[model samples]
Target chain A: MKKLSILILILSSAFAYAQTPEEKGLEIAIEADKRDQGFADSSSKMTMTLKNANGDESIRKMRSKTLEVQGDGDKGLTIFDQPADVKGTAFLSFTHVLDADDQWLYLPALKRVKRISSKNKSGPFMGSEFAFEDLSSREVEKFSYLYLKDEAVDGEDAFVIEVRPNYKYSGYTRSVVWISKEKYQPLKIDYYDRKKSLLKTMTVSGYQQYLGQYWRPDVMVMANHQTKKETRLDFADYKFKMGLSERDFNKSSLKRAR
Target chain B: MISKMIKTAVSCALLFGFSQVKAGEWSGYVAAEYRGFTQSKLDAEQFDKSSLSLSFEPEFYHSWNGGDDSFTFVPFARWDEHDPQRSHVDIRELVWLHVAQDWELRVGIDKVFWGVTESQHLVDIINQTDLVENLDGEQKLGQAMLSLSLIKDWGVLDLYVLPGFRERTLPGKDGRFRSIPEVDDHTVYESGAKDKHMDYALRWGQTFDDWDVGISHFYGTSREPRIIPTVTPAGLRLVPYYDIINQTGLDVQATFDEWLWKVEVIHRSGQGETFNAFTGGFEYTFVGVMDTAADFGVIAEYLYDDRGSDPAVAFDNDIFVGGRLAMNDAASSELLFGIISDVNNRTRFYNIEASRRFGDSWVLSLEGRFISAGSMGGPFSSIRKDDVIQLELARHF
Candidate 1:
C-alpha cells in the first residue's frame, strides 16, 4: 500500500508541471498589465539621438503627450521642435488592441494634415531606428504570449516571454521580452523579422517613479543589427494627470499642436 | 513700390515689438535658382534661354495673453534677372489668432488649401494662384480673410469672410510659361464693386478611422479669369475678366494599409455655363522594398471636365501617372516623376522633380519639364517650344 501511494504521488506531481507554455506566458502578461493600470495622462519632452554605422549622429527634440484609455489602446501625439526643416511637424495616433492604428502627420510646409496608411505602422519613425509600431503603446491583447523561462538580468529576477503579434501587418514575426519581476516593466526586448531572424534589440533604463504609483523610463536605446544603426531616446519633464481629454487629441488639434 | 512695402512690413514688425516677446520664434529661408531651357531661345519664343533668380521668405510668431492669443507675420520676396514680371513682393501671411475652449478666430491675410487630388487641385481656390512661380499651380498668393473655426467631436466647421481679392500673377512677356502675349495688369471685373466685393465660403471636414472627407461651398468672384484678347496702345494684350460664380466642392480619401484612394469633385455655375469636373486617383506604396529602407509608390489619376475640348484650360479628358521614390535616408532624399496625357489627343506633359539635403541647413533641388507636339493649340500652346530644366539651392535659418 505504501509503494502504491508513492507512485501515485509522483504521477500527480508530474501532471502539475505539465501546463502549456502559452498558458503560463499569458498569465505573466496579464499580471504585468494589471499592475500598470490607472495612469490617466502623461506629457514629456524627449531628445532623440540617431547614429549610423560610421558613427555620424544627428539630434532631434520633441514633445510627447499620451492619454490612457480604458478598454482601448492609448492616444498619443508627438510634435517636433528642433531641426529647422522638420520644425512644427506633428504626429498623432489613435491605437487599438485588435485593429490597425490611425495616424496623421501635419506638415508645416504644406500647412496640411495627411492621414498615414495603417500599413505604414511598421515603417521607421522620423528616420530613426525605432519603428512607429515600437513607439506605440503595447496593448496586451495585440500579441499571443509564450512564457520561456525565468532569468536574471543585471542581478534582478525577470520573466522571459516570447510574443507573436496577432495582427497581420506587423513587421516583426516575434519579440522576446524580459520583464522585471519587481516592477512588471520591460527591461529588454529582442525583435525578430518576418523571416524569424533577429533584427533589433531594445534596452530600457533610468527608471523613476511618478506620482508615487507609476514608473517611467527615462532612457531607451534601440539598435538595428542589420543596418548597424542606433537610436537613443532621453525623456524628461514628465507631468501626469493635467486634465487632458479626448478633445485635445482630435484632428483639429493638429493645427494647434505648436 | 516693393521697397516701400518692405519698409512698411519692417516698421510693423518693430512697432509690435515682436522680438521682445518671450518665447517668440523666427524662421525663414533664402534660395538661389538657375534655369536653362533645353530648347533654343528662338524656339522658346520670347523667353530667355537661361535665367537666374533669388528669393527670401521670413516668418515671425508671438503669443500673448497666456497663450490664448497669438500673432504671425510672413513676408516673401523674389527677384529674377531675366523676367521682370517674375520678380515681386507680397505678404504671405499676417494673422492674429484667438483660441477658446472649442473654437478659434483668425483675422488677417492667410493662405488656405483644400483638395485631395495630386494631379489637379480643383477645390483649392481661397488663395490666388501664383502662376509665374511654378507651372504646377502649387504656389499661391495670400488673401485677406476673417476666419472662424469650430471644433467638435464629430468634425470641424470653418467659416470664412473674404473681404478683398488678390489678382492672379501672370507671366511676363519674357517668361517661359506664357502661352499668349503678356496679360494686362489692369484686370477687369464683372461686378461693379470689383475687387472690393466680399466673398464668403464654408467648409466642414471630418476624419474617421480610415476615411477623411470634406465638403465646401464658395460664393464669390472666380479666381480663374476669362482671358479676352484686346488691342491696347502698348500692343495686343490679353485682358483678364473676373466673373461672379458659385461653386460646391467635395473631397474624400480612404486609406487602407499601403493603398490610398482619393476623389475630388466640383460643380460650378458661372461665366457662361454650368459645368462639372472631377479627379479621382489611387496611390499604392511598397515599403522596405528589397529589404531596404526605401519606399516606392505608384499613382494614377483621371481628370474629366464636362466642357470637353471647348474648355478654356484643356483638362477635359486626361490621365496622370506618377512614381515617387523615397530613400528614407537621413538627408530626406526624394524623387518624383509624372506624366499627364490627354486621352482625347496625343498631348502629353512630363515632369521630374528631385531634392535632397546637403547638410543641416542646405537643400538642393532639380526639376525638368517637357511637352509633346500634340500639346500645341491647347492650354500649353504658349510653351509648345519650351522645355526647361532648373536647379535651386536653399538655406534655412
Candidate 2:
C-alpha cells in the first residue's frame, strides 16, 4: 500500500509537468505584452500592402516619423506618397488613456491644419480604403483576452489566444492571436469584423531582440480581407528612451519637426 | 425615422419656437481639373489651365414629417487657362417651409424646373446642367425662390420668387478671363438703385408613369444692365440708360422613355423683344458591345432671337445648334463626343473624351477638344486653337 501511494503521487507530478507547454506559452505571451507596454520609441518608414476580395492587391507607402509611448499611446507625423496634390502634407495624432484621441491633418493647399473628431473616425482617409479609426493607437486595456490553444509556428511552439475589444466604435469585434512560446511575442492575429467574420489578418515578422530583454518586431503587416488593400510597417533606426514628453506633441512644435 | 422621444421633443420645440439640431448631415464633393484650350478662330490661340474647385452641398433631406423646413447648398467653381471659368457655385437652395396636410410652404432659392430637353431654359433653374455637356457656359447657380404646393396624384403646384444674378465672369475675353477672384462680398449697379436682384415666378407640374410635364410662368428682375457707358461723337464717354428691358418668360418641358423635350420664350415689356428656344434629346442602351451593356445619347437644339443679340454673349440672345454623343461600356469609364456650332458667329467647337475607373475608388479621365475656327481672321492674326488635353485622377468616399 505504501508503494501504491508513492506511485500515484509520481503519476500526478508527471501529468502536471506535461501541461507546462501550454502554461509556458501563456506566460510568454504575457511577458511580450509587458515588454511592448513599456516601450517608448520612434520609427521612420513603413510600407503597407492590401489584399482585396478579388485577390488583386494595392500598396500604400508612408514616409513619416512615428513616436510611440506605450501605455500613454502613439503620436506621429505621417506624409503620404504617390498623389501629387496630397504630397508634402502632414498628419498628427495623440492618444489619451481616459478620453478619445485627438487628430489633425494639414492640407498644403488649404495651408491649415484641421482637427478631426470622433464623428469623422469612421470616414475614409483621403478617400483611401482605410478609415481614420484604423490609424489610431490600440490601447492594451481596450481588449480582454482568453487563451485558446498551443500550436507550432515556424517549427516553434506557440500559444493561441482570442481577444475581444471593449470599444464601441471599433469596426471589429474579436481577434485571434498566435504568440511564440519561447520568445514571448505575437506571430499573427486574425481580426473579425462586427458580424464575427474574418475581416483582416495581421502578421508580425522579423522579431529582433532590443536592449537584451525586449523582443520587438521589425515588421507588422495588416491586410484587409475585403478591400485587398494592405499596410506594412517597417521599423527602422529606432531610438528608444529619448526622453520624449508631452511638450513635444504640441501643435506648435509639429511645424518645427524635421 | 423620428423616434418617440424625438417626436415629443420636436413637438415641444415647435410649440416653443425652438430650432436647430446639434447633429445634422453634411456631405459634399470637390473636383480639381486641368485643361488646355484649342482655339478655332483666326490667330488660333492655345490656353492651358489647372483648376481646383470645391463645393459644399449640404442637404436637409429629412425634417419633421409634418414640419415645413428647407436647406440645401451647391457651390462649385472652375478656373480655366489662368482665369476663372464660368463660376457656377451658389447657395443654390435655402427654403423656409411650413407643411400642412393640404399646403406646403417653401421660400428661398426655389425654382421649379420641368423639362426633358437637355438644355431647358424653362426647367433648368432647379438644377445645374451636367458639367460635361457645357464646356464654356453661363449657368450660374442663382435666383431667390418661394414655392407653395398641394401634393396631388399627378404632381404639385409650386410658386416661386426669382432673383436676377450677378453675371458670372467667363474666360477668353478681355476683363472676362481673369483668375478666379475671391468672391465679392457686395456689389452695386450704376442705376443708383443697386442690383435689382429679386423677382417672382409661379409654376405647376405633374408626373405619370415615367412621364412628367410642366408649364411655368416667371416674372422676375432682368439681368440685363439698364445703363451703358460708351465713347460718343466728341471723343467723350457718355452714359446711356435704356428701359427696353422685359422681365417675364414662359417655360415648358416633358420627359418620356429616356427622351426629353423643352421650350422657352421670353418677351421684353419695354423693347418688345422676344427670345425663344427649343431642345430635344434622348439616351438609349446599345447592346451587343463586347458582351457588356453600353449606352449612347444625342441632343439637338435651335434658337431664334428677334433681338439678334451680339455675338459676344451667346447666352443672352443668339441662334446655335449643339449635340452630344456619349458611349460607355466595361472597356471604358465614359466616352463622350460633342459638337457645337454658332450659326450667327460662324464658329464651331468639338471634343472627344475617355474616362476610366480604378478599383471602385478612383477615376482617371483623358479628354481633348478642338476648335475648327475661333477668330474671324484666317492668318497669323487669326485664332489657331491649341488642343486642350486633360488628365484627372480622382478618388471619392
Candidate 3:
C-alpha cells in the first residue's frame, strides 16, 4: 500500500494540469524543504580551507550550532576555535525569508557586541571563495523556481531547476541546481552574477543521514570562476535534537557561545 | 560583610582550585612592543624619545553542570623599561557565571563595554581606564561587581552592584606621555569611603528591526577624575579627585545595508560642572571595491560638549573623519586612519592603526598618533610634542 501511494504521488505530480513547469519546480523545492524540517536543533564542527589564486592555502576551524524556528527562518551561531588571534570571537545570525538577515559579532578583546550590516551578499566569508550568500539557509520562499529537466549527478538520477532570488538586493541573478531525485537533496549548484555571467560553482558530496531521516552533506567545495580562488568545507561531528530553543540563540547567549 | 568574606574565600578557592580541573580551555598571548617618538625630551625628568615594553595575558575557562555554570580567570602583566608606573599586574577578568532559564548571575571581577561610536565611547563607565597602556583610552582595568541579567523576549535588563573601585593609572614625570605638572601619588575623593565606595548601575537594551538601542543609568563615584593643582615639596603636581555623581546614557545604532549609523549621549552631574555631551557618526562602506574582496569605509562623526572647553575631556567641539580598510584575504589584514580636528581651534589629532596575522599563532600591529601644535586646554595643552609610533608582535598559546 505504501508503494502504491508513492506511485500515485509521482503520477499526479507529473500529470496535474494546473502544475506548469514553474509550479513543478516549486513543488519539488517545497517537497525538499518538507523532508528536512523538524530536527529542532543541531551542532557540528566546520573547517574551511581557502586557496588563493597563487595556490596559497589558509585554514580556519569553528564550532557551529543551528536552531530551527517553526514559522520563521533558522538561527545560527559559530564560534572560532582556531587561529588563536580570533579564538574567542563569535558570530551570530538570524535569517529571514524575505527581509535582510540580522547579524552580530562578539569581539573578545573588547568584550563588546557589534551589530553588523547583512547586505554583503557577494562578499567573501572569512576571505574564502564562499560568499555570505552561500552560507545562509535556503528557504523555499526566498526564490522563484523553474523546472528545467532531469539528469544524472554522480550516477544518481537528479532534477535540474533554475532559481532566481526573489529579494531585490540579492547579488545573484539566477542559479541552476542539480538535486537528487531519490533523496531530494542538492548535488551541485552554479551561481550567476548580476551581469548574468557565470560566477561560481559549488559541488556537494559525502551525503550522510542523521537520525535516520535527514540528509546532510559532509563536504562542500566552491570554485570562483572570475578570481581563480577556491574554498572547501569539511563538516563533521554532527549532533541533532540537542533540545535547543530560542533561549539558547538569544543575544545573551552570544557572549558565551564558546 | 559576610558576602565580602565569602567572596574572598571563593576567590582564593578559584585561584588554586582551577589547576585540578584539567578539562578546561586556556588561551592568551605574550607581546613585545617598541615605541619611537618624533620629538625630543622637553623636561629634565623625561625619558628619551624611545621606549620598550613587554606584556603577558593568560586566560583559563571551565564549565560544568551541563554547561550551565562556568568560571573564568584572566591575569595581565606588563613590564615597561623606563616608567615604573607602567609596569604592573592586574586581574583583567576573574568571574563566575550561572545561567538559568530566563536570567543569569555573575560575580567577581570582569569588564563591561557600552557605547557605539568610532570617535569615542562616552557611555562606557563600568571599568576604569588603564591609561598607562595607551592614550586611546580603550584599555580597561577589571571591575568587581555583582551582576544580574533578566533576558526576555523584549530585551535584556541588567543590574549591577559594584565595589572595589580601581584608580586610573597615570604615567609619571619620567614617562613619555605624562602631562606637565605630573600626577602625584595622592588622590582625593569626595566620598567618605574613598575607593571603597559602592556604586550601582542598570541598563536595558533591545532591538527593533534595524535599530539597536540601550539606555543605562549609573550612580556612584565618577570614573573620570578632575585634575586639581596642588603645591608639594617636590613641585606643583596635579592630583586626581574623584567625586560622587550620577550619569545617564543613551546609545543607538542602526545597520542599513552598507551604511551604519551610531550615536552615544550622556548627561552627568557631580564633577566640576553638570553638562551634556554627545558623539554620533555614520560609516558608509564600499564593498568589494574595484572588483576585489577588499572593503573601504568612510566615517565622519561630530562631538559636542555643552561646557565647551574641559581639559579632562577630549573630543569637545571636534570633528572626527576616518577611513577603514579591510583586505578580505587569508591574512586578515586591516587598517584604520582618522583625524579629530577642533572646530574652534587649530588643534588636530591624527591616529592610525594597522594589523595583520601571520600563520595561526602570531600577529603584528602598528599604531601611530600625532597631536599637532595648537590651542587645546587642559592636559592637551602640555603634550604638544608627543607624536609617537608603536609596533608590536604577539604570539598566542
Candidate 4:
C-alpha cells in the first residue's frame, strides 16, 4: 500500500508540471509585457508607403508621440505632416486595458476637433492597410492568448502564439503572432477575419536599440492576403523620454500640432 | 480696405522673413461645379435652368520663432455665371497665433466650430453662417476675434473677444434658393454699436473616459436676424434686424464601442421672448461589413424646440435618418444619404452626397437634394420646387 501511494504522488507531480497551451500563451504574453516596461515616453517620425495590387504606390508622412502609463494602457498622438491634402490632420488616442479606446481627430480644413466614434476602430487608418486599432498601443490585457508552438521565422527561433481580441467591434477574429526568443519582440503577425480566413500578414524588421534598453523595429510591412495590397511603414528619428504628458495629447494640442 | 492693406503688409513681411523661416506650407483646391435644377426658370430675370460655378481656396502657413509663433492666411473666392450673390470673395482665415506651454493666443479672423450633431449645429455660434455657400448651413464665414485658450488638468477654457461682425450673405434674385421676397443687404442693429459691438464668448470643454462635454456662452449681436418686411419703391423687401442676445449652449457626446450618442442644447434670450432648442442623435457603425474593407453607419436624430412649429429655426420639430458608407479604399470613396421629416406635417427632405478621390490631387463629388410636397408656412414651402443635383470636380495643390 505504501508503494502504491508513493507511485500516485509521483504521477500527480508530473502532471502538475505540464501547462496547458492557454496558460503557456498567457505566460509568454506576460513575459513580453514585463520586458517592454519602463519606456516612459517616446516620439518618432514615420513614412508609410501604400501599394495596390497594380503596384501603384502612394506615400504619407507623419509624426507620432507616445506616453506610457503605469498599471494602464498608454496614450499616443499622430500628426500628419505630408500629403498636402491631409496635412495638419492629427489623431489622439487614449488606450485602455479592458475598455474601448478613446480617439479624436482634428481636421485642419474645418478647424475643428472631432471625437472619433469608437466603433470605427476596425476601419482603415488613413486609407492604409492598417486599421485604427492597429495603430493604437497594444496592451496585453486587450487580448486572450493561446500558445501555438515554437516556430523558426527567417532563421530566427520564435514562439508562435494566437491572440483573440477581447474588445467588441474588432475587425479581426484572431491573430497569430511570432515573437522572437532573443528580444521577445514581435517578429510577425497574421490577421484572420471573422470567417477565420487569412486577411493580412504584418512583418516587423530592422530592430534597433534605444536608451540601451528598449528595442524598436524600424520597418513594418503589412500585406493584405485577400486584396493583394501592401503597406510599408518606415520609422526613424526615435527619441525617448521626450517628456510628453497628458496635456500634450489633448484636443487643444491637436490644433497646435505641427 | 484697411483690412486689405493690412493683409498686403503682412504678406510682404512674411515674404521678407521667408528666408529666415525653417518651414512653411501652402495648400489649396480649385473646384468647378455644375448645378441642374428640377424646375425651369420661374421668371425671365431668374437664373438659367442650369448654372456653372468655380471656387478656389488657397491657404498658407508660416511658423516662426521655433514654431512658438505662426501665421496662417487662407483666402477664398467663388464665381457663379448666373448669381452675382454667389460670386464673392472673403478672407477665410488670417490669424497670428502664439503658443505657450499651457496657453495659446490667436488674433485676427478665424473660424471656430463647436458641436457634435450631424443634422444641425445648434451650439456652434461663434462664426456667422455663410448662407449663400450651401443650403444646409454648414459653411461659416470667418470672424475677427482675439482668442485665448487655457489648458489645465481639469479642462480647456477658451475666451473670445470678437470685434468685427460678418453679415450673412444672401442669394440674389436670380439665385435658386432665395426667399419669395429677397433679403435686403442693409441691416438694422438692435445694439447701439451696430457691427462694432464687441461680442464675447466663453467655452469650457473636457473629455473623461468615453464622454466628451462642452459648455459655452455667447453674448453679442445675434447671428440669425429677424426678417421684417418693408415697402420699397417697386415691391416689398425683407430687411434683416440683428438683435442683441445672450445664448447658452451645451454639447455632449458619449462613445461606446460601435455606438456614439450626441446631444446639443441651446437657450437664447433677448429675441423678444426666450426660447430653448435641443437636438439629440446616435450613430452606429458596422465595420468591415461582409468581409470587405467597407464600413456602414446608421444615424438617427430628433430635433425639438419649445416653440414647436412657430419656432424661428427650420428644424423646429423634425426627425432625421441618415446612412453613411465608407469604401476604405485607396480612393477614399464615401457616400452619405439622409432624409429629414417634419414630425407634425407631411414634409420630407432627401439628400444624397457622394465623393471619391480620383488620384492624389483630384476629387469628384456628386450631390442631390429633393423636397416633397409640404404644408404652407413651413421653411421649405418657398423652396419646395427647387430640387437640384450638383456635380463638382476639384484639383488639390
Give the proportion of true interface contacts each model preserves, from 0 to 1.
0.42, 0.00, 0.72, 0.59
lDDT of 1 by residue, B1-397 (tens): 3444445446645654556567778987899999898876533337567889999988888888866778888888899987888999888887777788889898777888887778889988899898888888888887778899998877899999998677888877777777566677778998998987899999999987689999999999999898888887988878999999999999999988789999999999886678899999999999888987778899999999997856366688999999998887777889999999998788889999999877667889999999874845677776766788999999977
Error of 4 at B340 (Å): 1.1
How far off is residue A212 in model 2, in Å? 68
- Candidate 3 ranges beyond 4 A from true positions: A1-18, B1-20, B376-379
Predicted candidate 4 versus true structure: per-residue lDDT over B173-259, tens digit per residue? 888877776688878999888888999999999888788999999999999888888998978888999999999999999988778
Worst 10 residues of 3 chain A by lDDT: A11-20
Report the number of the highest-TM-score candidate. Answer: 3
> Mind giving the per-residue lDDT tens digits that candidate 2 earns over A125-182?
4434345655566555655667777887777788887876565455567778888876
lDDT of 3 by residue, B252-303 (tens): 9999888999999999999878999999999998888887788899999999
Give the poorly placed runs of model 4, Cα more than 4 Å off: A1-20, B1-23, B309-312
Sorting all predicted structures by DockQ, with the top scorer first, yields 3, 4, 1, 2
By summed lDDT, the worst window of 10 consecutive residues in model 2 chain B runs over B174-183
Q: Point to the candidate with the largest DockQ.
A: 3
Candidate 3 or 2, higher TM-score: 3
> Per lDDT, what order, best first?
3, 4, 1, 2
User: Where's the lowest-lDDT run of ten residues in candidate 3 chain B?
Assistant: B1-10
Q: TM-score: which is higher, 1 or 3?
A: 3
User: By TM-score, how accurate is candidate 1?
Assistant: 0.93
Q: How many Å off is the CA of A132 in candidate 3? A: 1.1
TM for chain B in all models?
A: 0.93, 0.65, 0.95, 0.94
Q: What are the root-mean-square deviations of the candidates from the true structure over C-alphas? A: 4.1, 18.6, 3.2, 4.2
Off by over 4 Å in 1: A1-19, B1-23, B42-45, B233-235, B373-375
